[model samples]
Each structure stands twice: as C-alpha cells, then as structure tokens.
Target: MQLPIDFQPGWAPADIEDASAHRFLFLQGALVVLRDGDGARLPDAAYRDLPIGVLHSVGVLDGRACHMAELSDAELPEGLEAVPLRQLFNRLPEALLAVAGRAQQLLDFARSHRFCGACGHANELFDEGRARRCPACGQVAYPRLAPAMMALIKRDGPNGRELLLAHGARFPGVIYSALAGFVEPSESVEDCLHREVFEEVGLRVKNLRYFGSQCWPFPHSLMIAFVADWASGEIVADPAEILDAAWFHIDALPPLPHQITIARRLINATIAEVAPDHPALSVYGAG
Candidate 1:
C-alpha cells in the first residue's frame, strides 16, 4: 500500500556517509531510539557519535540520505529513549513508520545471516547488492521474507451485510481481526487464503478481491490482504487456531485492529463500499 512519506530505497554505503543524514538507530534487540520531545522522531546528527556496530544504507527520505545503525550497547546519550518499532504506529507519520519497518527488517536480516549456513563460515556483505557472501563455499544469502494472507469474509445477514472476524488464539486481549495465515510451500496466495479461511473457521468463500499489502516487521512478513464473500458452511471456530469466530453487523462490532494495519484498511474499505452511509464510517474516519 502507498504510504504518505517520500522515500527512494537504495543500498550503497557511499551514498549515506553525510553527518546530517537521517539515521534510524536500533539497539541489540531491534529497539528503535527516538528523540524525547513534542513528538517522537528518529535521531539525526545529535546521535552521530554513538558507538555503532554496523550501518546499512536505507535509501533516501524526503530528499535526504537515510541509514539504519545498530548500536553496540544500550547506553543512550540522554534525551533519547528506546522503544519497540511497533509502538510507534500512530506516533510517527505513515511514511516514517513504513521506512522504519524496512530498516528493522534489514537489520534483522544482516544480524541473522552473519554466518554461512552451508559452510559454517563467517559471511561478508556482498559489494553488489543486499546479500551476504560466504567466501569458503560460494554461498550467498539474501534477506528472507515470509508471505502471509489476510481474508475478510462478508455475507448478507438478516440485519445487513455482516463481516466474519475472529480472535486468533495468539492475539493479545479481545481484539478481533480478519482471519490470516502464512502461505505454505508450493502454494499460491489465493490458495493459502482459501485454505486458511476453511481451516480456521470451517467455512467456504468465493469472489476473492485483492485489497492491498504491507511490509509487516514482526520479524519479517509481507501481509497480502483480500476480501471475499462467504459461500456456505456453518461457523465452527477451530479450537486450535481461533478462540472465537462470528459474523457481526456493521453497527455492532468488536474491537478491531489498529488503523495502521492493512486488516483495518480492508475492513474499512469493504464497509464503506457495502454501507456508504454507515455511522461506523465517520467513527473510523474512512477515506
């Protein structure tokens, strides 16, 4: 999906050596450091003196060079606090949030692929692109991404068009969101969506329509979302995957996902299409 920030991705180290460049500093555990002020922002020249272990170029943002730096220790230089990247959802602009996610994923990739799996040799950054090279075995490793599918099912109910939302077994609190699962080997995204829908809720769906995608950095995942119509089958929430599953009318809905997520966008867009004058539209600030 399109974000509101102006960014052009690049990986050359020489392009981001300027002291005034935007730097996304992260601790050992992928915690981002933000300047303490009116609103959180990525530290710039003020933190250029921190002991950085590694630095990776993350292209350009708003016509300025951007980079992601990994701090060797948790020591802060004062006026800065470390926070999880996910916690900056609404606090930072959408463009900045998206870029931060990219920075985190790139850092995670570099940290995890420090050694070659094939020869157990130390790996070095490849000069040509975003990859690690094993000089001993000629093995090259690139950043890995896991693709997942999110499906929002809808059908005409006695009251109106209702949506099928589920509280996943792993979900925190009582938040109910669209059903989602990862794509398995040798399976397409569409196949994964259909299989996940039936496996989680024991229901059939049809007329799949692509919604959009987001680069989720809970580790590294590309979430592809879609909307579908329920064809048949009764609600039988799988005890293994779903804590609860049901169809809710537009007016009466449970707590939804955060607005930054593609799941929320999918639900909002579908609701606006099905019920243009829905009061929920104004409540959600539907675009």
Candidate 2:
C-alpha cells in the first residue's frame, strides 16, 4: 500500500517564517478547498499564494476511495473530496503522525468548545492558541483524551496453532481484531484491559503484556495495546462492544485494518514469529 505524504512524523519542520504570528486557517476534514485561479485546495497558504500549511491530513478523513484506487504521485493540489486527517496517522510514522493527530484533536476541540455550554456565549482562543476560554463564565477548556485499551488473547492448544480473534459487528465482512474497550475513571490500564476482555467476550486473559500504543483520533481515542493468554471460557461478544468472537490458526486469518494500528501490527508480529510469510502481511490489509 502507498503511504500518505503527510503521514511522516515530524513531517512539517518547526522552522517556518512566522507561522504563529499569522492567522492560520483551518483546512478541516480534507475538504481541499480550491484556489480561484489555479484551482488549488489548501487550508492555509502563504500570503494566500504558495501552499504551505495543511489544516488536516488524508487518514483523518474517509479515504476508502483513495485506498481502493491507486494514488497518483503528485502534490496534494486543490479540489479534493473532504476527509478527516485522523485517518492519516497510521499511514504516517509515529512522531510526525502524532503532530497532526494531536493538532487536529486540539483544533477540533477548541472549535467545538467555542460555544459556551454554561452561558451559551461564544468562546475565544487563548493567548497561546492552544486552549479555549469562555468569555462569560471564564471557563478554561482543554482537549480531552479518552484512555482505552486493546488486548490480544492467546492460548496454547493441544496443537499449539490456534489464536483467538474477534469480529465486531461494526467490522466489515469477516474482519477481526483484538478485544478493545474504553478505560473507566480512576481505573488503571491493566485493570481496563482485564475488564474489557470479560465485558466484550466471556473469557479470562492472563499474562497481559503491553505491546505498544497509538493515537486513535476517530473522535479522540488513545488506544493502548496489550497481549494476553487465554485462561478459559467460551466465545461471547458484548452486545454493545463486540459482535462475534472465535479462534483461528496463526497462518490463516481474517481481514484486518491496514495502518499503524497496534492491533494489526501486533497480530502480524505474532504471526511472523511463527511463520515468516504471513498471508496478512500489512496492518491495514494489503491496501
């Protein structure tokens, strides 16, 4: 699969000509608003001439069309369909991806919180351009991060070739992924993992091992990944969180999301551990 240009971590260097001083326009949801003459759609161009800063990235938006179609090697010009930048993080490297992801979360949160909840008055951007404060009640607001965890359960069967997998109702076709859930207030990541497993599927997971983490901003989710071994119990999916659960062999697996997602990467990593030529080589499928 072709990687997105904006996916590079630290892609936009810090050094720029008076970026903070200028009134940067938000290029939201990959709208790709085109310029009048040249027909270029960039969010915040330099002097409204040369394209420089982008309001959002491709991944954040619905890139299903682009994903299915072959992406051309060219500058992201104007007149593109609208998609959110959140989808681009998995396409980008870690640090730079975080830059766009966090920035988007902050920008989106600030804009959404502009209308005061208490007084029903519009809020204003803070001095640092990082937060929003209500003019009436003087309420200070910051972007919220929802802490969530995903657990990959494994078990040593008599044949030692089976792995547990899950297919959420929301998941398309036969796509499967690890069990995931949001963290409760004051609950530790470890605690959330165990709870999520039981709630989503009627199973007990032991030997929980942290795999990695990624910023899943499909509306602000910091997904923490872990690997756990199945102790016992049958497959039972939560009516709310999951649709179906099952066990599959390592070599043969169902479809999975393609990207830097901890679920797909860890699955592939484990598959590689047993068999090098894993049929499902990529995290976001073969797209």
Candidate 1 ranges with C-alpha deviation above 4 Å: 1-5, 14-17, 35-38
Write one digit per residue (lDDT tens) for candidate 2, span 1-287: 22244443221222234332212223543423234343332233343333434332222222111100111222454444333454443333344344444545655675579687788788876645446788889988767889889888887667655677888877657778888889998899999988878878888879988888877766688889888888888878787767667888765676765545668877776666665665656433531
Q: Each model's TM-score?
A: 0.93, 0.68
lDDT of 2 at 42: 29
Instruction: Please state the error at residue 60 of candidate 1 in Å.
Output: 0.4
Deviation from truth (RMSD, Å), model 1? 1.9
- Model 2 alpha-carbon drift over 4 Å, by segment: 1-28, 31-79, 84-100, 276-287
Q: Pick the candidate with the highest TM-score.
A: 1
RMSD of each: 1.9, 8.6
Per-residue CA lDDT of model 1 for 84-158, tens digit only, reads: 876776666677777878888888888789999998999988956589999999999999999999999999877
